[model samples]
Target: MTTQRTITVDQARQIVFDAYTTGLPQAAAAKLLTGQATQAWVTSEYAALRRRGIPAMSGQGSLFDPAAEN
Candidate 1:
């Protein structure tokens, strides 16, 4: 049985990112959000966040990233 994606990939990333910045443990955050706080889920979400160049969920951000500059 396949479960429908209740949240989009973007939603998943934002949810995880918000939890990360708040300093909540990943497991707790995942459970609180998706009902399954598995390491694999967290890892995948984090990877997607980085792939999009979100600058790590360190609670600090800017309109532009110097690292993205060529």
Candidate 2:
């Protein structure tokens, strides 16, 4: 049997930031922090990190190849 952990926002922040350097997604960090990957909270937390001036592990936005069509 496994036990679940209860975490606070500060802990979530730490998980997000530290795990980000390890290529962990916001949802993944949320999972480690809150035991479940909630997109809403993950997104808000990610934005909070950005507001604190922490750059994401990867540059945002991907270069779309318009030439590739279905």
Candidate 3:
């Protein structure tokens, strides 16, 4: 026999990324996003956001290149 558990969709997504994705493990990513280095975290966060209906940025641009980014 087995017991079932309940979890929200958002929670499930978080778990999915935690279980998958490469570079900067989940805890560090979360901390970086929620705490310091918000902009740096945006790259990975946006990737996750894309999975949940958020669209990716258009065109090619370097975060380091202000002109290209715009």
Clashes in each model (backbone N, CA, C under 3 Å)? 0, 0, 0
What is the Å distance of residue 62 in model 2 from its true position?
26
TM-score of each: 0.49, 0.54, 0.28
- State which candidate has the highest TM-score: 2
Model 1 bad stretches (over 4 Å): 1-5, 35-38, 44-70
Which segments of candidate 3 are over 4 A away from where they belong? 22-70
lDDT of all predictions: 0.66, 0.66, 0.47
Candidate 3 C-alpha error for residue 67, in Å: 35
Query: Between prediction 1 and prediction 2, which has the larger TM-score?
Result: 2
Which pairs in model 2 have colliding backbones? none
Q: What is the lDDT of residue 40 in candidate 3?
A: 46
TM-score: model 1 vs. ground truth? 0.49
